[model samples]
Target: MDDLMKQLHAVLAVDKIDHNTVVKSVERNPYRRLLQEVLLERKDIIRSRMNLVALYETEEPSSEIEEILAQFENPTFPLEEINTEKEVEWQPLERKYLDGVSKIKEETTMKQTQLEKDLAKSLAHSEEVLKKHRDFRPVDDRDFSNVKQSITKHFEQAKTNLRGDAATKILVLRREIEQQGRKRRNFDKNTTDTLQNWFHDHRTNPYPSDQEKAELAKQCNIKISQVNNWFGNQRIRSKQQAIRMEEEEQKRLAALAAEESEAMQTALAAASTVATSSNLAAASLMTLPLVNPTMHAMVLPGMPQNLLAGTAGFLPQTNYFPTAGQMALADNGNGQPFYTDFENFGLATQPDSEQFNNYLG
Candidate 1:
């Protein structure tokens, strides 16, 4: 029994050593593991391919697949024997295809390079344009705005001042025109003489009619309004002169009446004395010589006929009465005299008949 047990132990120990050696050799061998992995991957690929074929076979086949199968079954050309030399030979079509591909790649590379250069140039040009704009641009926009506002304000003020000045000038010119209008126009000497003559001719009705005024204005070379004014003034002045003359005549008559009354009283006393002392017949004859009836008949021969006729009842003595023309001439060429020196001239109780006739005519 001991020999048999020893032999069994040796055999089991040898078998264990051989198993460990085989495991170690397998772990160290690179080709052996690669072979095993390749075999396992190949088995999995075959299983996936069989599953796909089964799935495709279960469904209906497409026309494209049937056409492909027909192409394989009835090829136009027989299978050619591949010559190793012909497989490596350069064909014209293959060379052309290769050249075309190479040319297209070269063109694409050139275009890409040109595009990069153009992009760089565009970027540079854009930067330059931006710089120039910045250089020419206004530094402060607010300053420009303020300047524009100031200019507008100045123009507005200038326009306002100009308008105001124009208005003021217009007002000043209008005032000057009004002042010129207010000034009176001086008439000529001829106009004055014409007006005076007409006034004397129409003394009875001094107010002229419209037609008469027009005629006078035409003759005098003056306006009708001026003629009317002249007539009005002449009428007023002549009336004042008439009043003055009447007052002077009244004073002279009163003085003459007082003198006549004194002379009568003296004569009466003398006559009474003469009658008592001397003969009554001589006293009566002396009184008759004192009262001469022909004394009033005395007149100057050189007196104007018109003056003589007008003074027939008032002042019959031409020596005591001057002609009306002389009285009119005494007035310095204005219209009429305001007062007459009747007392100094011994003109008493005489109406200016010649002047009245001339004025009426």
Candidate 2:
């Protein structure tokens, strides 16, 4: 990536000089031409975004380019021999060549900064839609799309700048975005593949067998408990979901059955409107408002079922099965008939005959 960027910058710088030749006399040129302007603008945006990285290149590389430009002033090496390290390294020639290169590099860097500022200002003034698109770009490329558009416009407006180093550098930025995107895709694919294989192996009876567990520990480079706990949690979550589904199904079925049974019972009750003694007594007992059935069922330990069955025959027709309130007040069973000494026990008084009849029915 770095090598490609250097090559790209070198191309842009060369084209910028050619562009300068077309538009202005070397003696009176006030500003750079199209390629120069574009390359300068790109450099500024890159400098700001990669400021930390730029410190090394901007300072060190500029110094080196300046040293090279100094050699141009004194012909320390013949023009044809400028590319050779041998003559260029000798005392007088070396210093001159170094200075010449340094100046050239500095001039190019300055040109880059100017172009960046121009691009940045244009983009900052552009439409909100363009601004939004720029914001979604990566940290390095946040200003790229807008910058590219501005460079294109500048070139069309200024013919001399049309075919220079700036165009080449812009292409470099695009290649950078592509390369980064490809790397990111590969990383995501690898992560997904690892996760998929892990889950596939664990899907059935997800709890790991001892051998599988050891292998997983080695593969993940983790403790056995970590793998064990993760599988345990996943299994528990799956079980809870299954149980909730089953409960929902059971409740649905029970609701359906209850609705049908209620309809049948409503019909049966209508047919038995003429209530009999047993029916009336049972209805009376059922109607009595009690706190809890377990307490009611405990009232007489070892109490014969036949006693409850026989109570219907003993109840007087006029009384409609003695009110439970009356029975409660009857006695506290210390050799007393429950009915005769009702006032002595701490119990409620009996209901009226009308309430007793309603309860019986």
Candidate 3:
């Protein structure tokens, strides 16, 4: 017990030592210092219990003792020596743990930095896209609300009007619709006649210009569109009629050409027959005898009287006429007969001057 009190007194005296001196002492003998601290703590607990027992014996107010006991009941840890052999062994392990933790923290920080950079880039791209979209947007936005409002108001007015006068309004609407839907207009007789005459006059180029249409409409007391439609229908009908007429004319020309060809053929055949008959008569006249014994001799009007008196002796005698065999021999390859050996007759010789002069006379 005396040794324990001395250790407690030494522990208490440690508080009076300079901080540097105590740290040096603890460093020199850390295990011994830890043993002294633990012994001091035991001595304090023992002292506190002894005081409580004395207060219980006296039966005096034990509030202070109870407080002291309560304080002692709380658990307290002994001061550990920082430079002991066990703590020296755990130093390297603690340093390795700190190094691992620092390494992990650095990796997490690097990952966080990279993630921040990527997020920043994505935000910048998004901003650029939004800016481009804003630039491309239309300068003026169209508003259809006014048109919608007008249409709604019109429908409301129409409904109100319809509710007020249902039957008469319906009749008027029907009449208006009928008028609007009417495709063909009924023109007066005079207007129709005038239009027909104009169409006939300009049948080749039936299309009318805007000015002509306007004039016709004014004259007819109608709209220009009506005049245009009338002219359009008239042109189509006239073209169809013209095509039909042209086809008929072509057919008539073909028929006339055929009739002319037939007439030409008939005239050619008649001319050929007349030419053949004339040729046959010429052949028969050439075949006739120059002198006929049975026929009476007729004197020519221009013959001399002396030649006419000698004409009997100049004529061929009936016996001197060629026989059928001699005639056949005299015929050349041509149809005309040719006489040979005419020089055998002395009459073929040149006549004397007296005879020739008599024949000429």
lDDT of 3 by residue, 230-266 (tens): 8888888878998999999999999996775565445
Residue-wise lDDT of candidate 2 within 1-361, one digit each (tens)? Answer: 3453354346436434243332333224333353344434445544443433333343222343344334335433332333344433345534544454455445655776676676566556443333432222222253345345544445233322322333333334334433433322222454335434776676775656788778766766666776676567667877898899999999999998677456435433532432322132223322322212221223222323322222221121222233444443222225442221112111123334354344334
Give each prediction's root-mean-square deviation over alpha carbons. 50.3, 25.3, 48.1
Pairs that collide, model 1 = none
Q: 1-361, model 1: which lDDT tens digit per residue? A: 3453343234325323343443344344456444344334334333433443444444343344334323223422111232224432424433443344344435544654665565455445434433332232222444334333433333333333333433343334334433433336678888888888878787777788899999999998988888888887888888999999999999999999677556545555653443344222223222322222211122111323333332222322222233443342222124433222232223334436466334223
Q: Residue 216 of candidate 1: its Cα lDDT?
A: 90
Better of 2 and 3 by lDDT: 3
Q: In candidate 3, what residue range of length 10 has the lowest lDDT sum?
A: 292-301
C-alpha local distance difference test of each model? 0.44, 0.42, 0.44
Residue 236 Cα positional deviation in candidate 2, in Å, after optimal superposition:
10
TM-score of each: 0.28, 0.21, 0.27
What's model 2's TM-score? Answer: 0.21
Point out where model 2 deviates above 4 Å: 1-246, 249-350, 358-361
Q: How far is candidate 2 from the true structure (C-alpha RMSD, Å)?
A: 25.3
Candidate 3 segments exceeding 4 Å error: 1-186, 197-205, 265-361
Query: How many clashes would you count in candidate 2?
Result: 29
